[model samples]
Target: MTLTESVNLDNCDREPIHVPGHIQSHGALLAFDAALRLAACSDNAERMLGFALPALGADLDAPQFAAWPHVTQAIGDFAQRSHGTSGLAERSEVQVGGRVFDLILHFNGRLVVAEFEERQPADREIRPFTTLANGALGRLRLQRTIDDLLQVAVTEIRSLTGFDRVMAYRFRHDASGDIVAEDCRPDVEPFLHRRYPAGDIPAQARRLYVINTLRFIADVGAAPVPVHTAGAEPLDMSWATLRSVSPIHIEYLTNMGVAASMSVSIVIGGELWGMIACHHLTPMVVPYGKRMACDVLAQLLASNVQTLLAADHAKRIEAASSVRVQLMETFVGGDGLLAALRPHAAALCTTFAADALVASEGTETFVHGGVSAAAGAELLRWLRSSKPPEGLLAMSEQAKLPPVLSAALAPWCGILALQMDDNRHDWLVLLRPEQVETVAWGGRPEKVYKAGPHGMRLTPRGSFDVWRETVRGIAVPWSATELEIARGLQAELHRAGGARRAQVARDRDQMLAVLGHDLRNPLQTIAMASQLLARGADSATVGPRITRSSTHMARLVSDLLDLSRLQGGLGLAVEPKPADLARLVREAAQDVTLGHPGVEVAVEAPPQLQVPVDAARVRQLLDNLLGNARQHGEAGRPIVMRLEASATQVTLSVANHAPPIPPESRDRLFDAYKPASLNNSRNPGGMGLGLYIACEIARGHGGTLVYEYHEPFVVFVVTLPREARAAAAGEA
Candidate 1:
């Protein structure tokens, strides 16, 4: 669609309404460069403005325009005040041709385009318009709903402009407009419920609506005045108040029998939401001051409407959040997401304002609310087949669906589907019933194409008679808030699923690592000893080695059996007899040295310290702790032990020359099946259950075991009651 192309119904959208090269007859447009040299002026400017029209005019210092210094002074003031911003247009009045005229000035690049319309003394002044606008804004602020707000607007605009009819038109998603609110005189025919097609306002015109807040036509039948410019390129009148509109639009008004018209754009979030349209049966003009006041009201109305909509979404989001909490409660209470959704189906239906839901997980399908089992199956099938790459799809008009599928889910006009996984097998589908609405159009909402003398062209509809339409297979559209909530729900479910899978995998891998490491070395040593004996090596050399290896393996196997029993809720068994705790710790160290001969051990204790503890279990606990130190401590560094006794209890601690345990693994150090380092490259033969068994042994004697990471050292401390007979009995 280029400027050179002839406009038809197919290409009118590119008709370029901004640089029209003309302006309305009621006003003269003059554009001057930064130096105040006239750059462009309307052809009628010589008659309207006493100054001669020049193809390239002289500067402000020229003798021709020296008499009226106010015009030049006003432009200088406007430029100084509106320095860097090219925002809204500013209005003022100047004396021209011995008559007062309204002046509107705005910037288009470096040029200051000014429009002058002859003003009458009867025109409303600026002070009264300020009072009128503030009063209208006060009324607007009192209305809570959009319908009420627009109702007040049309009434106020009609009263101010004295138009026969004034209406607030709201655009639909398709750009067609509906007369939502209207105020008119008694004799005028009311178009209160009329609708207009998008073609009535072309795309380029809509773009200008966002920039120019208000435009007026004193008389639609008046001829347009052409603008003459010195430059080769056409002037851009995007911000010019007197900028002319498309001839097709003028034809549209004349066809509708309108003599005069005015429109104030209702812009929201920088897009044209609609307009406040005024129509008159006789030629009429709204003074500049009054029109500016109406523009302010239109802007305020748009802001209030946007505020109302945001408030509605906020309420809905709050309620949906509460329902989500209840759903989560059900999810954790038992049989997976499907079960959770089954009982809360009615809640979900209300949360999103939906009619029914169909949830599918693998082979299982759950139908809830108003959907029949058969309809649920069909909906599920469609969701899986049409799953988007991101796995969320929303359809507002089910008439767009295939005929077979649409018939299968009759009476439903919307479907919102969320897939549970990357594969399309699982889904949660929300269904909404069709809302059939009847709309009344001002005329048939379409273009009429006919062959003209020049070529084929599109014409405006000839009639303004009422045309009604029954719109069907469309539900209330899914809102942005509902879609955002659905996205959050899907993401949360995926995160929970990932966490569950990781935990299960982690547990299994840790167990396998421990079993492969702890049993491998002992089994290998026994195998080597048996081979050496069979190859005629002396029994004296092999027997003790084989016996020691067998003992270690047997103890490991027994400890594993005890853990298996623990899983069945049994406690470790222990017999308490008075014994020297110091001796037990010493013996445990000596045995660990036999396993790792190069490792050294040191003991610091009162040798005679005694307690009612099971000596064998205490020795086992010591052996496990010592083995952990030997495996992990720096080579050639000695493991240290210390013991202290009190009247009722005794404390024993083991210190090893090893790096401190990482802070993240500290809490789970005493838990079974968790290794010190997640990195598998650490020295092996540690089942990660040493601390668990030691803890259990301490519990058996009514005591506790704990670990701490001091810089450059790892320490395990144990505390036991001096008289453990009662504690042992309690454990049994």
Candidate 2:
């Protein structure tokens, strides 16, 4: 037979579990029509309820049911009170045939379903709920791993319910299940480590498992009775405790030699993660209270499972982060990209267990281990053509490869790649070699044909004989943790590339702005001076104008270059010698007075204040400061230049009467290209680089430049060491 024919794939998911047409022998079920007439009863009704099956049209209050008068009134009261709802009534206890039973009633469509189960004796000793629950919780808490936890859960549940076998079956990403942990009777064959296909529990059945956390079948071999209704419709017994089960499921259980079964769902993050399945070789019924306890246990276990999984995930992320830090450091500290990643290539490839790694930038390819150069080129071409997502792109099998590239990449079955840049064709690829794996399936995982009352139909596999198959053309599966780490690496690389591009763009724009605005006036002045000389104007007048314009242009260019060098991590080059500070201050003040003839300048300093310094750079520093004071300071105010000498340091203070600096601009005053104020109309000609250059000069001389606002005046202070040893050492 063909695979599909053998497993009966057509009927796998068609089983109507809600209307199974059967009920457990431990309970008696009866359905009444809209007229309140007894329409149907279970075949075992006479044995359990001490009453023969009622005729199809007999009244529900017949003489056989008169022994319990409460049943008739209870049904009437339920029908009246449960309006506009599911019509399920609260269970009531009644004595019939000298035996107490718990009666549950609910309306399904036009029929009312009543089910009865034998109640526990009044004198039977019951175990304390708190004791059992606390013990189980304590044992569960002591488990440090998921395996230990599952083992404890199945053992405790089986012990509590007295089932012959209990297994913790965990679902995979594809909805297939594996028996992770089990506790069964020693005489029975173990189902541990067994796997089941996803089709075994159809989609609809999985939905019901989520809705109803727990389900039980007292006996799989019990006879079913038709749930009759005057309208010829079947009742939906999805929520009924004693509802009949599907014949296919019954056959499935019987094939395994199981007479009863129970299942409790284990949900995590609002999704069904797995289930706790229980089975027995003989018919059995679990009490409501015990089932309630199992439900609580399942909930607690689900919570613990979430916590443990999160902890494991966090641990993996931490390890990956460490590796990422090392890789980034190497990339940043080395000369070229290929050379940087080369030293750490093995470490990077091992993160996801790939046999080879390739780093590609444009047409250049750097291989780490076993990947061929042709394969790398082909992979890159495919990646560029496909334009995959920004994060990690993973392919588990070579079949996913393009036809043109599949034969070239035959040695590698899997590829995990990440694009490092959004605008560039730079990629990091990890390749895994083809791995052949042998998987032991419970059966062929195909449907089989069978003869039934309705003629030939599809059925589930009846024989669970071990069927081993060797799977080829695939590599080892990539784990969630590995994929997460790959995504993180991709994000980090993208951010780094974006930052570098942004810096380059900023630099280009700043250069353009300076060339277009700040340098235009100086160049124009030179042109005007040359035109005057060419026109035979007075030689002396054109000479000074030409000299002044050229000097100004040179100073602007020098300041720009100095700022660039400082930013590039090359500090100012200076030479220092013993000099008279008071003389230097006097000369700087005289130069400022020449430049700004209208402004009054005052100098206060002791004579012969000697210090070791670079006189020219210090002069440049003073010129920039005094020039800034003239441009932004009040026009009529006197500028004060003061020099103070101490044992080990000299302080130069320049003060002017000007409006206080705005709070927003104070922090970025010494930053290159940052305007002195947002309202640039006040000081329009300045390039905002003077103060930045001044600060760099002061730092080069082992001094600091700072600004302070004093209500009516702003002060710029320069403090330098008297000996200037740092400047001398830097010069060397």
What RMSD does each model have against the real structure? 16.1, 13.6
lDDT of 2: 0.75
Clashing residue pairs in candidate 1 are: none
Per residue, candidate 1 scores C-alpha lDDT tens digits across 1-732 of: 222335585667877678888888888887777777888888887788777654566675566667767987887777767664554467778897688888888887667888888877787356877898888899999999999999999999888778999999998877889999999999898999899998898888898888888888888877778888778778888877777767677667877889899999999888888899999978787788888889889989999999998899889888888888787665543334565787788988888889888887654567776667677777778777776768888888976888888888878868888887657777888889898988789999878776433345676776889988898989888877889888877776666545644663686487766666667878888899899999999999999988977787787687777666543335567888989888787778787777678889998988687788788888889988887777778888888888898897888888888878866676556655564543345444445677778887887787878887776779999989887643324311
Best by lDDT: 1
Backbone clash pairs for candidate 2 read 6-447, 6-448, 7-446, 7-447, 7-448, 8-447, 8-448, 22-244
Q: What are the per-residue Cα lDDT tens digits for candidate 2 across 1-732?
A: 112232245555755677666566678777776677877666667778886655767886787667667877777677666662554456677677788777778776566778888867741233565468668988998898988989999998988888999999998776888899999999977888878888778876886687667888888877765445444555567767777776667667877788989999998866789999999999887765566678788888888998999998898788789888887765544322454677888878777677888776533467778777777777877877787876458887878887889898787878888888765477888888888877667777766577743346665566777777787888876777888899988887777666645654574476557656767887888898888888998978778877877787787678767767765545676677888888988998998888768888899999888888888888888988988887788889999998998898999988899888877676556766553332267556556777878887886786789999776889999999888665323221
Off by over 4 Å in 1: 1-6, 451-456, 503-732
**TM-scores for every predicted model:** 0.68, 0.59
